[model samples]
Structure formats: structure tokens, C-alpha cells
Target: MIAIAIKNLSYHYPDRTPALLDINLQVKRGLKTAILGMNGSGKTTLLYHLNGVIPVESGEVQVFGTPVVKERITEVRRMVGLLFDNPDNQLFSTTLRNDIAFGPRNLRLEPALVHRKVEEAMQLLSIEDLADRPPYCLSLGQKKRAAIAGLISMEPQVLVFDEPFSGLDPALGRQFRELLDELVSGGCTLVYSTHDVDLAYAWADEVVLMHSGRVLKSGPVDLLCDEKTMMRANLPVPLLGRLFQGWNEKPRTLEEALNLMGSTGLAKGKRLQA
Candidate 1:
């Protein structure tokens, strides 16, 4: 089923020009979709509409079959969780534990249930050790995970990340990818706005490419990364994807590509994997 649908969406900041125009998007439940664009191409604006953080200025936005309006704001918020680009902007509590528990507490769930949620989220993000420390005391990576833990405490059906892959080192990026896989395995829909064409192609089941506030392409990852579409969409071809293209292979995971490369001696004398 469609978890979120945006039809012919148009929006503009009150003091600025249009940020998005003639946009159309559909996100399926329990799947991972990436909204990809260069900076200032309305990816974040589209994410706001999906999370119901901003009112739709024109066209229509539906969350779980309900139109996002004044009355359905709470429901929309409950159905979708947004993780901001900067963790400091989102994590405000004095202690990390309290911050993670904030959302369920606000929902008035039982204390025991709230505690369970916080523990689970902390474990998922591997931030359980930072539970009692203040958010500001944590490192950049820990703070990001804590902020995400806070959002996960609410148990929203749809999870949206605004550049989750940003500022993370290779190790932390791998951790976050594992966390996303677990979330999707548990039937949560995931959407992320990003400029990392490589990560978008690697992690997203489906990709939506935006240019100048309009969709240049939207389809399964394979089709989105096709040479013609990547060129026409003005996106750099991911190295792994480019290798897949040149070899005309259907390998899915990075490990498969590694195994293939070793067997075929493709990277024997080159800096291919690195």
C-alpha cells in the first residue's frame, strides 16, 4: 500500500521563491526509498511534506490514506518520524535517556512501556552506553545516534532521515546502514533525503531523482542507475554501479561485487575497491 503520496506538489517559503514545483511522489509501506537531488533541489521540502511538518501550500499530500491538514497533523506525525540533519537541533533534553524517552512519555504510554521503547532504540543505535550522559557531552556520531533514538522511541511507521549518511565516517555509516536494514525488516517504511548518489543507490530499494524541483526519474535502483538515466538525470554514476554497468552484471550487494571481482581478477592491478 502507499504509505505516502504527493501529487503535483508546489511550495515556497514565505519570503523566498518556490522551493518545489510540479512534484509527484509515492512511497510504499515497508520499503526503503531515497529522494535524491543536488543541494537546494527541494528534497528536504518534500521530506517535510511527507512528515507533515509543513502544511502543503498547493496540490495534495496524503499520509496513510489521510490528507495532511490541520486536523490530521497529529496522526501524520504519529505515522511518520523525521530525523533532522543536525542532531543538536533535535536532541534537547539534559540527559540522553530522557531525550530518548521524551516522545513515548509525551504520548502518555505507561512508564514501563516507555522504558522498553527507550532501551530498544538505544540498543538498535548502539548508544546504550550514552544513556545517562547529556547530549551535548557526546561526540558527533553518538549525538546523531541519540537523536535518532529519540525519534525511534515514538515507533512511527514511516521513518524519514534528512541526510543520515552525512558527516558519518565509514564505520558509523556501516552501522547506520545496518540499523536501517533492521528497521525495514521489521516492516517500517524508510525515506531519506540525500546527495550521496552512491549511498542512495546502495541503500535505497527505489530512487527518486529530483532536479530543479521536479522529478527527473523515479524507479527501482537498477533502473535509476542505468547509464542513460544517470546521464540524463545529471547524477554521477556510483563506482560500484558503474562497475556493474560495464560488466552487465545483476549483482545486488557490495559483497557480491567483491566476490565477483576476486574471481574475475578485475581489481588485481587497480584501485577499484578503494
Candidate 2:
């Protein structure tokens, strides 16, 4: 299923500066898609259009075959949950539980059902321990998780994130990745924008490279291996891509790379004995 489709999409700022120019794209359902671009490349602008946060000046956007028009804006938002680059923008309630519960409550669900949804979201994020703490006092990583829980509570079919790992340490980043994996395993379509080429290369099932408010290229993660495309997008070649350039086999993570090296060494030792 086509989860999202953008056609001839263009947007501009209040001063008439173009933010997105004639963009066309389609995202498949249940795929982990990474939008790769540098700062000021219109990544966030495109994301805003996904959830109707920004009005579409010209062109059309469809979520699950429903056109994103004024009449359907509310429905679009309900289908696509967005997480801002900064967690503070989304975490406004005092307590963590309140913050996560805010969405379902607004939907006017029954009190008991809202409570159940909030608890389930917190557990899914493994943030049950922080339920009683104030969102304002939580660490950056914790705040991000809480912000995600807030969206999860909404039960949106698709989740969109902007620069999700901006301030996370390696350990916390791994945790976030695991959370994302769980979401996808549960049939959620995931879309996120990032400038980190390495992470995009290693993590995404599909990649879209944007430059100067236009999509330069979009295809499978192997697109990152094209040095010319990476250079054109002003992105550095991912380390693993550069290391295993000509080899048909590529390792997507550190553990896989280590295993590949060990296997290669063992094969070489056997060859020497023969």
C-alpha cells in the first residue's frame, strides 16, 4: 500500500522564498524510510506537509488514498503523527503520564480507555519508571522517548520524526533504534529525516536524498553506495559503504562487520593449509 504520495508539491515562506520545489515522492506502507539532507534543505518542510502542519501552497498530498484537503486535514493528522526536532515542542504537560495521555484525551475517549492507552504506550517505550516525573525535568533522551510515547498513544498509522537522534548518546541511540524496530514490527510505517549519512545507510530500508529543496534521488539504501550521488547530495559516503565498496557483501552494523571479518580470516587460514 502507498502510505504517502506527494505530487508536484511546492511550498514557500511568508516572504515568497521557495521551501519545496516541485517535489514528487511515494512511501510504501510498513517501510523504514530515511530522508537525507543537510540543514535548510527543506527536510522539515516536507515533513510538515505530511501531517498538514504546513498548508500546501501548490500541489497535492495524499495519505492512504485520502487527499489532504481542508476538509480532510483532521483525518490526515490522525493518520500521521509527527514528532518535532525538539522534544520540548511536544512535551507540554507537567507529568510524563499527562503528556502521554494528552492525545487520547483530546480524542474524547473513555477515561478508563485513555488510561489504558497511556500505560501501554509508556510500557512500549520502556518509560514506565518515568511516568511520575515531570517532563520538564527529564533528560534530553528521556524527553524524546516521552514525546514519542505521546504520539504512540494517539495510535497513528504512520509516525514521522525530524532529527530524532540529534542529541542522543550512542547507548541511547541504540535504545531509540530498538524502539523503532518494535514499532515497525507492529506494522507502523516510519519516516524520519536526518543528515547523518552513516545512520541512514545502516538503518533505512529506503532512502530519499534531497538537495536545495528538491529530491535529487530516491531509491533503496544501496543508493548511498553511489559516491557520485552522495557527493551531489553533499553527503559524505557512509563508512561501511566506503570500506566494502567493491565487495558484494556489505555489513549494516558493527556486529555484522566483525562477523564478516572473522569469517574471512578463517577462510584464508583454511586456504593456506591446502
Candidate with best TM-score: 2
* Backbone atom clashes (below 3 Å) for every candidate: 0, 0
> Which 10-residue window of candidate 1 scores lowest in summed lDDT?
265-274
Question: Weakest 10 consecutive residues, lDDT, candidate 2?
Answer: 262-271
Q: How high is the CA lDDT of each candidate model?
A: 0.85, 0.91
TM-score, cand. 2: 0.93
Among these predicted structures, which one has the highest lDDT?
2
lDDT, residue 169, model 2: 77
lDDT for model 2: 0.91
Give the residue spans of candidate 1 off by over 4 A: 262-274
Report the C-alpha lDDT of model 1 over 1-274, residue by residue, as the tens digit. Answer: 8988889899989986788898888989989998887778788888888767778899999878989888888888888899888888888888999999999998899999999999999998888888999999988888988888889889889998999877777897898889788889999999998888777767889989887788888888776557776777677877687667767675666888888877778766466656
Query: For every model shown, what is its TM-score relative to the native structure?
Result: 0.91, 0.93
lDDT of 1 at 267: 66
